[model samples]
Target: MTPVSSPYVPDVSRYTKRESRAVPVGPIQIGGGAPIVIQSMLTSDTMDTGACVREALDLVEAGCELVRITAPTVKDAANLRAIRDELRSRGCPVPLVADIHFKPEAAMEAARWVDKIRINPGNYADRKKFVVRSYTDEEYASAVARLEDAFLPLVHLCQERGIAMRIGTNHGSLSDRILNRYGDTPLGMVESALEYARICRKAGFHRIVFSMKASNPRIMISAYRRLIAVLQELGPDWNYPIHLGVTEAGDGEDGRVKSAVGIGALLADGIGDTIRVSLTEDSVREIPVAEALRALVEEFAGAPRPKEALVPPFDPFSFQRRHSHRWVRNAKVGGGEPVRVAVLEENFAALESASAGTEMVPELGYRPGMAEEVDPEDPATLAELETGAPRLVTVRDGCPYPPLYAFRMLAARIPSRHPILLKDTFFPGEKGDPLRERLNSALQVGALLCDGIGDAVLLRREADPKKALELSYNILQATGNRSFKADFVACPSCGRTLFNLQETTARIRAATGHLKGVKIAVMGCIVNGPGEMADADFGYVGGAPGKVNLYVGKKAVRFNIPQEQAVDSLIALIAEEGKWIDPPRS
Candidate 1:
């Protein structure tokens, strides 16, 4: 499939949910300007009808609008009937979804019992051996015909039964055809899903949602933006609601930051209709995080004041770090250096006392007042920029636009070679509510970092510098801008998980947490493990109930290692690859 080019970047000047065809999932509607829906998948076994019912009730009780359960087999798909029946009897009328992969028969069976069916287009009808091959035009057309035959049956079943579908594409699971055609790119991810979507569209089935999920926050954000642009080019009727998530976003604050940066960045501009904060922890715990992210972008409902029209100078569908010449002797804040941390000299005096145990030292301690002030609302400031000597610049305070857009406006007008000091608080010396400050900083500043706009970041008026430093570094790591510690990509636990994901992830972190720059993926199952951690250097994935499969960049080197011995083997594998180091004695 070829990508259609369109000048359809989200307007950063204000926040408004993107309009889409309303997709009815049971009693609730997604998109068409409906309230952003929150959903999560069940982690309990589908065969355990009692467990499944209990889990569904818990999610519904926690305010989850939709619940998804994995149906990897026909038997598992059939059991959804019992699960649905039990939930209805218990007065829980929440919608149910069947998560299907590589199984059309199971998807068809699942369509009969659930309100929605989510099929990975990579596996719906196409084969993926990760082989290097090319498809001739006729062969490619034949493949599309095959996909049509396999997918339209379920589309017809769904249309007839008043069911919805999500053509959810995973970065790690593209078909050989798509991979050979588009490589492993954001375009590839979009095309993979659009092929199936076109099949549905031709059959007059439009009750569909689309998602482009990747573990990398940058990739996840870019793919969603690209997906929207393509949809716009396709026509107005193709306004399908988007499902936003960063798959295998790990757990805890790390997971939250990853989810927020990728999903929140889009949410700031009103791109998602529904969201799932994928975490490696409890599925129920995901709801409140989703709610918080949903609320954070609510201010976008209207402009605080008249704002300038959005005609950004950067590409929204791809990340190209804003070019800047090295301005500092340390070369830490520009000219291809990792984004630096900063504490303005005025704030430094206050933060120095609270910084006893913190390792972070701002690279530039000069007062922010000393930098060139770029007023975002004024185009004259942008045109005045000179690229001769590298200048340190920061957005002027009281700019009508939010940080995400303000910096975007700042970035558009500046000499591309000047380093920018990204600030968390635009107001100087005012200690606002800590929670609000944190959310604004994480969502707004984090979004800019993902856009490759920041060269240095500071939580300008944050009450606690220690906490601010922690949050700043985490955001940088989450956005793939820098890594100060060992990184991980872990999927939220689901019914298909073969082993105890939470406990295993804990164990892996305990042993490998100190390996800075080494990214490890802990997956509960093979379904998404190999492909999901698109960036991890090593992998610990569940091969079976009592077994583990260890990988070195998607290649399984050790299979069925006893669960008890898996960690040791994984460590040995890391050591053999010359990527392991003894943790510093503490």
Candidate 2:
């Protein structure tokens, strides 16, 4: 596959900051070289003015720069005026964004109230029926014409109301028209938004932001890169700010790892203007993750750009692990081996016991008596260790140097053949949770893994060791290094969902928790399920009320099964395909 090139010319800078025209949203600015903005959405019902105001205020207090509320109907859109009034009365005048799907009238009403309006291009004017049909040239043109007729009114309303607009394209939610035309790829995600962009430009509306989001980090990163290339081709005047996110990133460590891998990878390339870390947890909990990611971009923002390293051998557009010699026989890593996992424990007995039956490599701090383990921070000790010993080198957190720079320095000095373990520890100062710490660790360690630098990862915190181990593999999974458990890709429930997404996702995960090396996507609806779950081994999607659709790869093999029996049916399908293995006797 051809490597995707950066949109900007090659430079010494780590990221080629995509220059964009700053669009004003309320008192703050996005793009145009503004500091990367941090934003979050309120999960409270929009019609409940009190609850919406309280949540909006809470998010703003937690350092959220912008707040988004769902406006599913004309009434909900109109209710935003009341919510804004209550917030202003409370002396919290933060900018409000109305999230609209499939309702132009709601969008129009929202444009009149909120500081910005976000419309999903996949469902803004088109309904997703999961139908596959061919459209002739004239028919396609007519459809575009109808889309413009439906969307132009909102464009004009936003322009007149001085409200900015975000054309957010979700990987799982592309219109059937776009999917049929573009085959549900990154190109389709970009084209879906660009189609709306074309209409906006024709209507002379320029205060726009664009986002290409996906549950998969690779897809999200690739789509954003391709979108920038397409925008650059359109001309310099079309440089709209990008809002970065990984939608439906499930809760806790898994969510953080997934969000960081997708958002951090793009931000490292200097691609995002504003960011939202969409966790399945409380909306307020999302602020710290966003702040941590922003801190990463800021750390490099003003520093002198380092000289570009040797052109990497791997493709930038796609993921392919970098080649390195497989030096350690006991703990195999690099040279196309499955990425290893390492656990950092001060206790020798615990470390020894943990490594006995598993592939986990044990890492310890420097001490004279412990000859069996490797000291991750000290190069001299590592050099003295007997050749071929089961050594796992560590690059610790809170180093004097930047973490990635520290890793590079260690990599340069150590033998390239040795299996190195990357470690990150977060003590979320007061007022922070373990979730925030997990996100920080993921961002710190994940950055190196994305460049194919580490063999294994060790995420440490004051929390449970098991949680840390889980986080280690999650980071590996997010970076596409390894998968120790079934990968669950589910969307966070939205107004368009026909069923209870969170509850259903939990049911699916509970039933399949023991299946290793499998990928299952539990999607709330068909809007983007068939396409977004394209990489999944099997998919359980909401087809209709109390009905589920099952997929093997992208092909929907079973349609409209009762929701209550969906999990059993999915397992039966997996067993039929000979991919299911019974759990070991406990």
Candidate 3:
């Protein structure tokens, strides 16, 4: 099959930064060297006008530049008008975005009331039944024609109303046609959004943004990079501002770390214009995290230019683990070993106490016989290392050099066979919270891992060792280095979800949470479940009312099992496949 052509390029080195055309959304301007914008979504029912307005106001006050609300139907889309009117009346005139899925009419109606409209091309005019079929040239052309017929009105309407559109494509939600042709990969994601973008361009609708979202950071980062490459090939004028996000990132540390890895990886390459940290927690809490990520990206982007042109050691557009030699036999630090997690404490006692019950290595800056820790300012000290253990290099915030460049300089001075432990410290002080701290660490530390620079990561902050350990593993997981716990890839509940996603996810997690290295996806619907859970070891997806489907790596093994017995059935399937390990005796 011929590869699809994209309008953007993946060559980050070609441009000092990704220079995009400024797309105006209400009073806000995105891209074209503008400050990266922060965005969040409202979880309240759209029909509940007061609730929606209240959430929107809260989001704006929390530093959200753009607020999005779901519009699953025409009634919900119409309700946005009331929400917008109330917000405007109340002095909160933040740009509102209508999130549309499988509803073109809703998109048209939403275009009139909102500053921007976001539509999922996988389902806007196409139904995803996981059907697989080959389309002839005529059939494919007919499908495109039909899609244009359904989508053009909204395109024309948005253009006339000066409303920007985001052709956001979800990894799990690609149309059957796209999957049949592209096999549900990142290429499929780029093609899905490009189809709608081509339509928008033909209609002279240039005010558009594109996003390629996924639950998996690897897939998400790969898709966005591929989209850029395709877009660069399309034309200079086709450089649309890209929106960055990781869909269904679970709450707490996991969510923050995942969002940071996917969004931060692209941002490090200067690829994102607007970003939303999609956490399962209240949308208001997402703002600070997004703020921290943006700040970190800006810090790196504004770093002093290297004295000489430095090419990246690894491909920025693709995912490849850095090659290294293993350090220890039992605790492998590098050389195809899982990225290790270490705890950096103020003292040896504190490090030992914090890492007592875990496999996490403990390192102290001042302890003798411990791993060598060097400050970025003093590189000559690296030559004095007498111990053969991997060195623990601390790259604290407020360093004179950009973290990336500093790492490169350190690598140049050190021996190639010596594995290095990257420890990133953040002192948020009065300007940060737990969420901000988490995001900052992920961006700084996770960015290095994505670039294949670190073999182990130790995040140091003024928090307990347990929390730090959890965060270190999360960073490793997000960077696709390790999997500590059962990877729960659950979607944030939306209008299309048929069952109680949160409750079901909780139950599934309770039963299988102990299965380390096992990936189980709990999806709310079939729209993107099978395809989205492509990386999962097992899947529990909603099939119909009061029914569920069980999948083993994207292939359905059982159909329509009663929801009550679904969990047990899933466990049984896992055991039958020899992946089940019983919980230890309490």
Candidate 4:
């Protein structure tokens, strides 16, 4: 859960119980003051009437309030009727939604049978040649006008049929105008959807859901967050249901984790109305994943949970595989009894008690991990701050070996700013001056002060005969200090400190500015250097002149270096440790 500072908690709390205007579908009410709805789409061909019905029923059993079917062509659009009829015949009353691309006929066909229709404004505009393909102002306006006219009729048809509409904007199919304005950000997707949503509102149809989907989880999460923020400010009175999804969310576990993190983030903040866990694999896989993610919210809100009992009949067609029927039934049942899962406060106690099985009780309240009493004397205060700043620290490596270069390459590989910290400034007393005591004190104080103000700090260390830099970095990370800097551990070399240790260390530190929240170490003297540098995200040690040991965590990667050019070699190594720059002190 994203910890809310006291001040922002109210901002979030405002929406917690605020009722939204309901958007009605056969038996379900979306948007206006409804339960957080779980939804998914069928990957089976829509034209395969039997397959579509089977998938839809599966999703319904999984607890899906609605299921969207892709109607790419007029032929596919006809499946909506067959699918809806099949569901109704089977005693499943779930609403069917048609997802159409560009063809207006497809939309019309689905609108006749499906309860809802989702259309891409960009795609609709793409078919009608109005805009000059070449960038020209006069041609663009003319195209925009034609595009608006093209969608106005579809909006009118939806209004006439009393069909709900979702203006889904994909990252791939952005409007040229919006793309030019906002670039290809999730924001652009939001703006594009908003333009269509505005058209719908003007057409006197308030039944709407907006979706902005991206293949990238980070981009998807940020776009949704921003969209909610904008809607909160722009249409406080209007609570149109928002559809959540991670488009093209890969396949299997990789897809599941990404979608979970992205959707989970928004749902945790109480932003989503309906969620779809998009996966490249069969849409059937999407059902269970969506239900699980929504279950988190249920668990958090202390709402009724799905029955933990294994499927009684273990039927392959059981709804448990599609949606959490148990949870929804519990919600409908409304006895307000809690559901329980296995959670032991003390594993040792559970192990010790031979007769004890899993505790079966209702979820009463939030159980935070690692609860501890706050100590006033601790420099960092848990009291939430008003700043909406994130509380993440970067992890970087400051080793001066081949691994450092590996770190650098990784940093360069990332599209965004390397989040690890950079460590360049040497702490006082590295040379073992009598000032070592004062330096350690200064460093610790610096850490505490930075942490109190919500900063990520990096602990830079040296490669010595005894410890690895990663060990030091981990020790600091365990502090959960917002003021954490990447750990930079450098060696204290003497005239006998073999392998241009000083020069390599300094250059490695200089190279770390790009990365953030990293712990790196540069050490000399093979005999004790490797062991001395512990807890470093990356480590580079002086290993007999032309060779150096590079480490990620405690694992070493072998690298050969020429003794005469060891400093440059070390620089190359540290660079590979990715970005390990210290976060800016608060």
Task: Using TM-score, give the best candidate's number.
Answer: 1
Tens-place lDDT per residue, model 2, 167-234, is 99988778888878887788888889989999999989999999999887777877887788778777
TM-scores, all candidates, are 0.95, 0.79, 0.84, 0.52
* Candidate lDDT (C-alpha), each: 0.84, 0.74, 0.76, 0.51
- Runs in model 3 deviating more than 4 A are 1-17, 135-142, 344-399, 408-418, 425-434, 495-504, 525-528, 541-551, 555-578
RMSD, one per candidate, in order: 2.3, 5.5, 4.4, 22.9
Residue pair clashes in candidate 1: 172-531
**Superior by TM-score: candidate 1 or candidate 3:** 1
**Cand. 4 TM to true fold:** 0.52
lDDT of 4 by residue, 88-206 (tens): 99999898888776688888778888778888755655532222245467765676667677778878888888778888876655656755655666567777787777777777888
Please provide, for model 3 over 1-586, each residue's C-alpha lDDT reduced to its tens digit, 9 standing for 90 to 100: 3454443333322225688999998889888889999999887778988888888888888999998888878998998899999998998879999998877888888888999999998889986877878999899879988998899999999988898889999988889888888887888899899888888889888999999999888778888988888777777898889999998787667788889888987887778999998775677988988888888776666666544444455555566776667776335566677777665435546666755755444532332244444543464676654346555444444555645555655554555555667656523242346666667677767877776777776666536566776677778777777765778887665545667776788888889977888988888777547866767899898898889999999899999999989999999999999999987555
**Candidate 2 clash pair list:** 172-528, 376-394
Who is ahead in TM-score, 1 or 2?
A: 1
TM-score of 1: 0.95
